[model samples]
Target chain A: MFSIASSELIQIFRNRLVLITSLIIPAAVSAFFVRQHETYADLGSLGYIAAIVLFTVAAFGLYATAVTTLASRRQNLFLKRLRSTAEGDAGILAGLLLPVVVLTVVQVTAILTALAVVAGAPANVALLVVAVLATVAMMIGLALATAGLTNSPEHAQVTTLPVTLGVIAMASWVGITGTENLAWLKRLLPGGAATELTMNAWNGGVAVTDSLLLLAPTLGWVVVAVALATRLFRWEPRR
Target chain B: MSTTPVIEVERLNLTYGDFHAVKDLSFEVRPGELYALLGTNGAGKTSTLEVVEGHRRPTSGTVRVFGHSPDDRRAVRPRMGVMLQESGFSPDLTVRESVGLIGRLTRRTDDVDRVLDVVDLTGRAGRKVSQLSGGEKRRLDFATAVYGTPELLFLDEPTTGLDIQSRDAVWATVDRLRENGATIVLTTHYLEEAQQRADRIGLMHQGTLHREGTVSELTHTLPGVIRFALATPVPPLPLHAVVDADGKVVVESFELQKDLHLLLGWAQDHAVELRDLAAGPTRLDDVFRAINS
Candidate 1:
């Protein structure tokens, strides 16, 4: 399993698209903050932006990565070939998810480090830790959820559009709108939980109250996504 | 013969929504035998092979690999290898990486170098899969299939898109596997492949097994082609079952010796010499066309 994971990580880095998405997107998003530093007054605001950037990288790195990889593998009959081997279904799935999970972790760490060194804002370790865990779970769930609907590798990008766009909208809009009426709707959204948790954490200590609220929906999405993916995920491309 | 068949499909039926892809299919492959499932496009050859490989479950009936159901039991997979019609390796992965990953899935570790050598891919093992040509990539796929030295191997259209040389190379590998006592289930549209490699051939048409027998047995059962051009345009004889517009007699039958003797007698009696006379056993291609039509 570790060997399979290592090989997968190697291949993911070798892929120009995956490489660009994992590294370039987060760097570009972080650069956007550096450019707009004068307008952001507080460390909390900067941390919020960092959280949004981290969330985006996680989505692309973990969720989008997983769905696209699985779709392409299915299209190429890689999943089918794996099924023929001694590797059980779990091992095969773990192998596919390994690269994305590792990339997500690396991207998140890079973003947090960039915030500390370049942006001159120290990270709240406890809040950052919780935020990172939530981001990982959310992205993995979103990926499995998206993979359930993707029938082919070619359709992977299009099928993932809904989640990608939804996360961006939720993360970007919650800060701008600040409308009380939208809180309930945004709370259920994937990135909304991370955004709120990051905002509370960046202010001081861990936001126990906000983190607790986000946990329910986060866990729910993860459970549902896993179930759907297991049921609907096909090993072979439909002819 | 061993008591346990390497592969057994009993009254298997599969349907894709409203369309019946395979119906009442049944066959058994013993250890050390090369079994060919010969069919045309959409003839359920792939569907049948998929079921045996546990990629798809039969809507009805049972598939057993070494007396274990492939759909229900995961234990049989380790002893089996498969070469799917379409490959699904990461384009960025080198041939060695792909083969090495497959090797890890087996109980016995296969020497990656030796497997690459068997497929004649040692030189290109470091090359990315995307950079390899069609034939080279196919060799890579074949290398992965046999990497584990699987006891039962399923090859679906294994030689498609391969150059003549590469095809022959794959055939040699198949021969080697058979010599090592591996049971192979192969599906191919290439009749000559089936004729050359199969210990027993099963003909499938319209989701049904139309015929099943050894290559020689099928040839014996199918009609032979007796073609001859006459010196003079003689009256059509009963032996001239099918006459071409150019006045050449085409006779199709199993009794080639008797037919040839009778044809000679008729020519002698009429003082007409037969030109371009040819008599031979029917090929698998001929048998396939005759049965399908």
Candidate 2:
């Protein structure tokens, strides 16, 4: 698994298009949000800015990148080649996704740290960590499910747009509108509950128990995404 | 050496929705022997190979590689090497890196540089797979499959895009591996390769095993041929012969030697030149052609 991960890391850096989309684009977008943190914070709050930035990196950097990578590999039969080895199916997937997952974590951590430094630290760092981890898990699951419907890296552009845009829109809605009017409806959506949890962690005063309960919906998305992935994901391209 | 089959398939069937890609096919590849599975287009050789390689599951029946299920990768894969019909390396990775990654995943260890040299790709080691030509990519695929020199190897059209020299090099490497008692399962369009190297062969047509036997056994079922262009028709003195559309005198003979001698004697006595005279036993190509007929 480590061998495959290391090879994937090498390939990620070597491919210019992938590097631009997966790393540079997400970093640039996150940097803009950080640079304009005061404006976004005033519109909602520092917590709102945090949720948007997290979703930006998660949607583009981790989620879309993962989908494109898997689609590209499957299109070229690389996944089939890998399976020809002694590695198990689970190990092959873990190896392929580990680099992207770890890279996204690092990018999110750095951007969030910068946000904390400039906008004052969150009220609860531990709760914020939980929110980030849960968000990453949910996005990764969705990426796998999305990859099944994608035929090539080119196809990923079309397939990924709905989820990427939906999650970011969800974060914006939950963060800006405060979920006050339709709280249950907002939380029931894929990213809505996670966005609210991020806001409570950063802005505080939401109660640890209440924040912890937000995890149920996010974890529920994870379960649903994984189930969908199992049915949808294909190792070899259609003949 | 043990005489137990290295690979076995029993009543194997594969279906893709409504299409029955492979019917009830059964064949076994014995140890230390080269077993070539030859077939016409869409003959289910690939589907059968994929099932044996564990890339796909059999719709019904069992396939065992080295006494274990082919899907048991931990047990079966480490002992086998597969060269797929198409090159599947990452385009962004260098040839060396591609081989190294796949080799490691196979849980087999060998010097990457040495393997590159075996396929004459040491000079192109640093080149990314995207930059290599078609034949070069094939050699790179071969390099990875032979990395650990596993006990069993699957060569799927291993020489399709290769030049003659590179093709010879690949066969040389396989020859050396066989010398060390490696079992091989091969599938190729080149019938002569199978005729020359296979200890036994399984011929598939329309998703069934059309024929299976030693080269001699398969070829003996068909008559040998003798052909010659006659400038002046004067062959009413010996064995029966027919003129083809090409205006060449053709004779299909089970007793090739006796018929050839009689034709030569007749030509000599008549003072007739048997232009382009050729006589040979039935080749694998003939056996293959016989299938459709």
Best by DockQ: 2
- Go through the candidates in order and give each one's DockQ: 0.62, 0.91
State the lDDT of candidate 2 residue by residue for B221-251, as single tens digits. 9999998987775747488888876668889
DockQ of candidate 2 compared with the true complex: 0.91
Which candidate gets the maximum lDDT versus the true structure? 2
Give native contacts recovered, as a fraction, per prediction: 0.69, 0.90
What does candidate 1's lDDT look like per residue over B1-293, in tens digits? 58578888999999989999999999888788899998877889888988888878889998888888886435886787788787777788889888888777654578999999999999998998888888787788888888868888888889889989889889888888878889899888888888988999988988999889999999887778788776566755757477767777788877888988888887788777778888989999888778756
- Segments in model 2 whose C-alpha atoms lie over 4 Å from true places: B245-247
Whole-model lDDT for model 2 versus the true structure?
Answer: 0.94
Error of 2 at B68 (Å): 0.9
After TM-score superposition, the amount by which residue B145's alpha carbon in candidate 1 deviates from its true location, in angstroms, is: 1.4
lDDT of each: 0.78, 0.94
Candidate 1 CAPRI level: medium
lDDT of 2 at A126: 96
- Give the root-mean-square deviation of each candidate in angstroms: 3.0, 1.2
